[model samples]
Target: MAKFSVSLKARLFLHDHGKLLLLKQTKPNGGNYSLIGGTIERKEFAIQTLIRESQEEAGIELSEDDLELVHVLHKRSAKEHRIVLYFRAYHYDGTPESKELEKFENVEWWSLKELPKNLTGTVRHVLKAYNAGLIYSHLRK
Candidate 1:
């Protein structure tokens, strides 16, 4: 068997009032809207990564008790394999904003029924599957 590396990431779907929170990436980073989260560090768990990333990227504080695992994405590309855990949270502390100035330019909210066309492909896929009540999804490229 061939050995390959798989990256683990945790993302948040912070939804409220029929709207979801998104971070707008800088032009250098593709300028697309993305979920608020980050890669899971070597020593951290998925929930811990989400909590830390939410606070760092969006200034929102999350508790493990408030987060629910909604979807899991297994993505494979020619050069990389990644498994992303998507968590949905209704309750959090602080207002959402772009705290990572270099990576994100703005923070925006869009209705689930009317998502922005500029959303990243992965985000679009995950949202669609999530809304359809699917807990697991796979994407290959």
Candidate 2:
């Protein structure tokens, strides 16, 4: 029998004043901007997942105490199911940079009111949901 599982991932929503931080990607999942975070490892708590992923992807240190739950998206499609938790942190340590040089060439902060055009649909939805204060939502696509 084939095993089935739902992957849990944590994504960050880091904002500096009115500017939002974004990691520049290439094609397919790149050439667009998305939140900096990754999958929750085995035996790791959700907050811990954010902390570790932030350091890896954005090269910044995040604290569980400093993280606030902004949104949670549970999504399902034909091939995959995932539970993504969005955490917002107003403050963190170190300047943000792309650790994956090949995958991401640059990281920039864009105005929250005027985000870049090449953004993932999911990310765009998340941003709107954040702005509208829609805490929990589900996406099927």
Q: Judged by lDDT against the true structure, how good is candidate 2?
A: 0.85
Please give, for residues 64-97, the per-residue lDDT of candidate 1 as tens digits: 9989999999999877899999999999999888
Q: Which stretches of candidate 2 lie over 4 Å from their true place?
A: 1-4
In candidate 2, position 51 carries an lDDT of 91
| TM-scores of the models, in the order given | 0.96, 0.91
Pairs of colliding residues, candidate 2: 25-31, 26-30, 26-31
Q: What local lDDT score does residue 63 receive in model 1, on the 0 to 100 scale?
A: 94
Model 1 spans with C-alpha error above 4 angstroms: none
